[model samples]
Target: MKRRSNLLTIGMLALLVYFLLPLFWLVVASTKSTGDLFSSFGLWFTADFHLFQNIGQVFTYGDGVYGRWLLNTLFYSVVSAGGAAFLCALGGYGFAKFRFRGNSTLFGVVLAAVMVPTTALAIPTYLLFSKIDLVNTPWAIILPSLVSPFGLYLMRIYAQDAIDDSMIEAGRIDGASEMGIFFKIVLRSLAPGIVTVLLFTLVATWNNYFLPLIMLNDPELYPITVGLAAWSSQTAGGGGSTGDLLALVVTGSMLSIVPLIAAFLLLQRYWQSGLSAGGVKG
Candidate 1:
């Protein structure tokens, strides 16, 4: 038993190190000057530091374009995550609680949608948005992200246990309207599941690259993922100023991850509860 426990501990530590090592490298690399990056050390300490200088250059270079991308990413992430969570909650509540026509069939279709890859739908979505002149706008990203099939599925499963039908009925019996009952009773009860869905949507929208790559053409409208890719390409192409875009990209990647980390920390308890309660029948 002791041998097995030691082996398992070592294995888990190795896996943790494997995932964190890349992020550690990015942090150290972003702080080092270009010369020091290549010559001084691969994973060791750098003799010459350029952390502040690189950050200044990242903001100032290209007329502060990185700031624009940062804002766009935030906007897209907030809207998509919040919208998707709300929509999923509504849809899931309706499917789980209401006795509507063809609810099972409709839910089956939604389940099928969960099986479909978002990437496969990107081309059709781009075409549809382009026809409506919504392409190249943040809506192009935000709208599609709001339609999360997995979120719908998660909410459906979560709503089954997270919310009680008796509570909703009591709310209705207490002179509450349908909307009032749903908003006041059901939604409040499903808070944990809502946060879970929000986190899922936020992460997906934040890291999404391929959909934005196909939907958008204007660089000014690019999310951070797309913007970073463009910068990487420019690095390869020897673009103007020869600024340390690599460092900026690295620092920006770190900055981009901060919001997610903060969000997880804030919502971890709710997320854990929601997941644990999902599909757990009374």
Candidate 2:
């Protein structure tokens, strides 16, 4: 038993190190000048830290392009994720609670849509949006992101367990409308599920690169991921080597991950409890 425990502990530690090594490297690399990044310590802190200088350059380079990218990303992430979550909740609630013609068929279609790779549809979506003159706009990203089949599925499953039919029936008996009952009672009970869905959609939209890559053409409309990639590529190819955009890219990558980490930490309990309840009931 002792031997097994020791082996398991070592294995877990190794896995943790494996995952964290890249992040540690990024932090160390971001502090180094381009020259130092290649020449200095690969995994440890530098003797001379240039983090502040690098950050300044990251903002000032290309006329504050990073700032624009950051704003675009925030807009896309918040609008798409929040909108998608609300739509999913509505769809899920309706599917779980209400009966209508072709409901099962529509849900089956949604399931099939979930099975489809979002990346695979990017080209077609681009073409469709182009025909409507919506390409290169924020709507190009937000509209597509607003329809999350998986989120809808998650909500349906969550609503089925989190909300009870009896409550809706009671609300009806008390002369409450469907929307009122949903808003007043069902929604409150499904708080955990809503948070879970919001986080999932938020992370998905925030990290999304491929769709935005295909949809938007204007440099001014670029999200941070695409914008950072452009800068990183240029820096990697030694376009100008103006204060190590590459280093800032590393740092920016590190910074971008912070929001995701904080969100998970803050919502971990709700997400876990929601999943546990859904699983137990399902």
Candidate 3:
């Protein structure tokens, strides 16, 4: 038993190091100038402290375009994630509580959609959006992101476990409308699932790169991820060697993940509880 315990402890510690090492490197790299970044040992601080300088450059570069990109990211993430969560909740609640024709078949389709990679659909989506004149607009990003099959599945499972049919029936007996019961009671109970979907959708939209890159042509309309990638690309083939855009790219990458980290930290308790409840019940 002691030997097994010792081995497990060592294994856990190794896993911790494996995950933390890259983050440590990114932090250390962001604090150094480009020269120091290339020359110095990774995962350790250098004598020069350039984190603030790099971040400032990131925002001010190209006439403060980074700030615009950050705002665009915030807009896209909030709108898409919020809409997706609501839709997921509605779909999940309906699937969990009500019966309709071909319900299981429809859910199976959703599961199949989940298995399909979004990247594979990007071109078809682009063509469709172009026909509708939505390409190169914020809708191009927000609209596609608003449909999350995984979120619907998660909410379906969560609703099944969290809400009781008896309560819903009682609400109906009291002459409450279905929407009224959902809004007043089911919604409150679905809080954890909603937050879980929100976080997932938020992260997905915020870090989305390929879709926006394909959809939006205007640099001003770019999200942080795409903007950072553009800056990162400037270093290719010795093109942006005259500027600190590469350093700015690294620092910006570090800053870009802050919101995601903060969100997870704030909602972790609810997220964990929701998953546990859903798992145990279903």
The number of clashing residue pairs in each candidate reads: 0, 0, 0
Where is model 2 more than 4 Å wrong at Cα? 1-11, 241-243, 272-282
The sequence of per-residue lDDT tens digits that candidate 1 reaches over residues 151-231 is 998888878867877898798779999888888888877888889899999999999999999989998999889988888
TM-score attained by model 1: 0.92
* Candidate 2 lDDT over residue span 1-282, tens digit each: 999999999999999999999988888887887778788779987888988888787788788988888888888888888898888888999999889999999999999999999899999999999999999999999999998999999999988878888999999999999899988988777878778788888888889999998888899999988988887778757755445676888777776777788878988887687677778867
Give the top-scoring candidate (lDDT).
3
Tell me model 2's lDDT, rounded to 2 decimals.
0.86
Candidate 1 vs 3: which has more lDDT: 3
> Between the candidate structures 1 and 2, which one is better when assessed by TM-score?
1
Q: What lDDT is reached at residue 38 by model 1?
A: 69
**Tens-place lDDT digits, model 3, residues 1-282:** 999999999999999999988888888889988888878887799889999998888888889999999899999999999999999999999998899999999999999999999899899999999999999999999999999999999999989879989999999999999999999989988989999999999999998888998999999899998998888778763654536676788888888888889888998988677678778867
Model 1 ranges with Cα > 4 A deviation: 272-282
Please list the residue runs of candidate 3 whose C-alpha ends up more than 4 Å from where it truly belongs after superposition: 239-241, 272-282
Candidate 3 lowest-lDDT run of ten: 236-245
